[model samples]
Target: MRSILIALPLLIAAPAWAQGDDSELWLTATGEVAVADKTSIELESINRFSDDSGGLYEIELAAGVKRSLGDGWYIGGGYVRVVNYSRGTVTRTEDRLRVQGGFSTDAGPFKLSGRLRLERRAASTGDEIGYRLRPNIKAALPLGKSDFRLFAAHESFLPLDDTDWGENAGHDRMRNSIGVSWKASKAISVEGGYLHQYRLPRNGRTSATDHALTFTLGVSL
Candidate 1:
């Protein structure tokens, strides 16, 4: 039998953009408890910047809208905030704003969706960055009593640490993951998988890498 363990992240990832006008409002509250092998990525000099970089626990609350256009394409925008209380001493608060465009359709028992994210972020260190997250494609399959899905995603993070000067930090990150989804019921779904993420090096340094086991829960409004 196929594993039902990998099911949450991909299911909720793009349903918000499956089609145009499918749902005007979307809401979901997911409480996930996981052990992060690494706390944070190492930037450059440690004395200049201090972060725990240890095991971590995270909780995320997300709510947004999925608007579909008359054509097969759709566009969506929303804000999600995450509060991280690390095992290490540092407490981090992250806020993200994204606008996404996608195309969706169904093939027999499965549905396919794709999206791109344009974003800006302000880090706790008071660094603001502009970047793009994309190639986030998902496919949902119906398997008799339950459902399944697959996701492929790549996210890039840019550094705007120096708005004061034209000199840029020139840093970006990329993440690649693959997982499966199980529709436990209308109200919830469970998913977990392996995520390979690497923080691109900047200013003559090596890259930081992480291979993490990710679990996500999906709920409906």
Candidate 2:
């Protein structure tokens, strides 16, 4: 636990590459099943589009299992695969394994949480290995007498290794988002939000900022 806490800051200080400025749109679908009182299985698929919803650029599929540790603490692990498309051609693919842990607590009329995740990534370019760390915090406010809640979150990712593509050693990406979640039914919920992302370059290029409109549909079974 102490070592994990110490690793968070170190990972943020490592070196990375530039993504030119752009706006994007994202749609995500997610489902979860309870295998036990304290354990659950989760799955998600996401689609990413470029500015003006002009073109499809990326798709991601992920699955994972999570377990409660009691008292608002939890641990989970997952695998993800992402495919990138550009100019009507499949350009790159990334496969990643991730382990994460977090804690949540309630304050008056709100819930707050923090999470830490570590990842091992392999890309199709050369199938090289790289590592990453991500830390984030979230807040939720429930609307009185309604099944709607306001959500806000901020997260940052740091690359930890040098690969054939480039050195992703420093603060690579940051995302700030705000959204509203509506409980449409007992087992279904939807969320819509906007995200602002900032990215730094690894190949000595200019950095970029991306504005994105995001929507998610979640179902629990």
Candidate 3:
């Protein structure tokens, strides 16, 4: 019962050094797939970052990618893999990788689109967390599409490395959410939200600003 850092799975460590301009004008990418008719189907990610002043910021590796597609639907492009056991260890890739294009319209029953993501992370406990970011929002009925919708985010994290494990931790980590989105189509969907955060130990729950949940089951063309 230690879980924090916005809902955990044990990921921390990786981010040799990163300060600014990694490219792609300042990267951003997002990808997902979720299908839950019987469970065991999920994939999700966010990349591109830079937010400072010791609330923490900086992720300087580059390209990240993941995969998993079955009854749940999955895809991979970047943000490789990571786990922060309150500051244990996990790492795969880094530098720059973010994606976003245009148009996915509909607002009556709900369906909207916007994209940009990229991440090269790993830094859960020691430095708090490193962020490679691409900020963009408006997800109403996603992951197979609509079981529930409504979401919002304002992000910035460019923390490549800094570890004393104190001074505002890793700096700048903010998230506000409203939940319930479970789709089993277009690829997949399953989400849980309503988490106001700033954390550092998940899977058991400690505290740093509590009650947060995130789920990912993904796939996209």
**Top model by TM-score, which number?**
2
TM-score of 1: 0.60
Model 2's alpha-carbon lDDT is 0.82
Residue 45, model 2: lDDT of 99
Write down the TM-score for model 3: 0.25
Segments in model 1 whose C-alpha atoms lie over 4 Å from true places: 2-52, 57-60, 70-72, 84-88, 107-110, 127-135, 140-146, 150-153, 156-171
Please report how far candidate 1 places residue 49 from its true position, in Å.
20
* Best-fitting candidate, scored by lDDT: 2
Order of candidates by TM-score, top first? Answer: 2, 1, 3
TM-score of each: 0.60, 0.86, 0.25
Error of 1 at 149 (Å): 3.8
lDDT of 2 by residue, 37-57 (tens): 999999999999886335889
Once fitted onto the true fold, the runs of candidate 2 whose alpha carbons sit more than 4 angstroms away are: 1-20, 52-54, 201-203
